[model samples]
Target: MKIGLYFGTFNPIHVGHLTLANHIAEHSNLDQVWFVVTPQSPFKKKSSLLDNHQRLEMVYRATKDYDKLRPSDIEFGLNQPNYTIDTLTYLHEKFPNHEFALIMGEDNLKSFHKWKNYEIILENHYIYVYPRLTKVKTASQFKDHPKIFNISAPIMGLSSTFIRQEIKAGKNIRPMLPEHVWEYLDEMNFYK
Candidate 1:
């Protein structure tokens, strides 16, 4: 199976994440899209960030109904401050038969060159780039690279930070999250 890894902290999984993952899974040749829940870096603690399992639970609730989407906590067991290269290598070894690709935003593509072992990553796996509201230009090398595919998914301006802020301000951000995820957050009193 071909799986596209969509990495995020997902402090609280929301609609924007679901929509983007679903769109890519349905529109692209990828067989499935994995919402790879990134674990918090041990070096930089943020008060607002939920525990890794809590965030993973939110992701599970958000994606439970989608056949093509699934939640992944692969990074939780890895070393802290893990890089993409490490995770990719680990997954490749674990699932040798499956072809893995990366799902990223246009904004990340702009700074792709700075990532550790970026050349090795490009040589081994494909990258699926979705549109983002960024003015920065992508690196010229990636503009027409064979390993990189530009997916014309809709640009979602919504963000987890904005949702958290709205919740903290006592605003009903129900529309911004999945029904189950909203209930989970409400029950846990997260970001409030």
Candidate 2:
């Protein structure tokens, strides 16, 4: 099986994330797109992130209806601050029969060199890069890499930070997230 690992903090699984994952699953030739909920990101701030369990639950609730796109807590058992290479390595060991591809945004590809063993990641795993609203594109050096794929997916400008701010201000952002997730956020009064 070919699986695309769409890893993230998923502080809250918003519509943009779901849209991107669905696009990848439908167009990227992968059998599944797993939203690997990171417990901690080496590159992001942890202070404002929701607890991993809550974030994972939100991912599950938001993606329960989708068969190909779903949430994964694979990184929850791994050591923090989680790095992509390490997680991919562990996954390879556990699922030796499956071929795993790393799914990321073009904004991330711009900083790909900063990651640990980036060359190894490029050499071993296939990369599916979805476009983000950022000006950043894939770096020139990696443009011709065979393992990398630049997918033309629907652009979702909505962001989790913006959604959180809207919720904090008592604005309506239900349309920007899954219906169930909005209810979960409301029931928990999260981000208030």
The top-ranked prediction according to TM-score is 1
Instruction: Write down the lDDT of every candidate, Cα atoms only.
Output: 0.94, 0.89
Model 2 lDDT on a 0 to 1 scale: 0.89
Query: Candidate 2 — which pairs collide?
Result: none
When summed lDDT is taken over every stretch of 10 residues in candidate 1, the lowest stretch is: 131-140
lDDT of 2 at 109: 89
Q: Each model's TM-score? A: 0.98, 0.94
Please provide, for model 2 over 1-192, each residue's C-alpha lDDT reduced to its tens digit, 9 standing for 90 to 100: 999999887878899999889988988689999999878655676676888899999999999999998789999898877788999999999999999999988888888989999999988999998887766856888888899999999888988888888988999888998999999999999998
Cα lDDT tens digits, model 1, 109-171, are 988999999999999999999998765688899989999999989889999999999999999
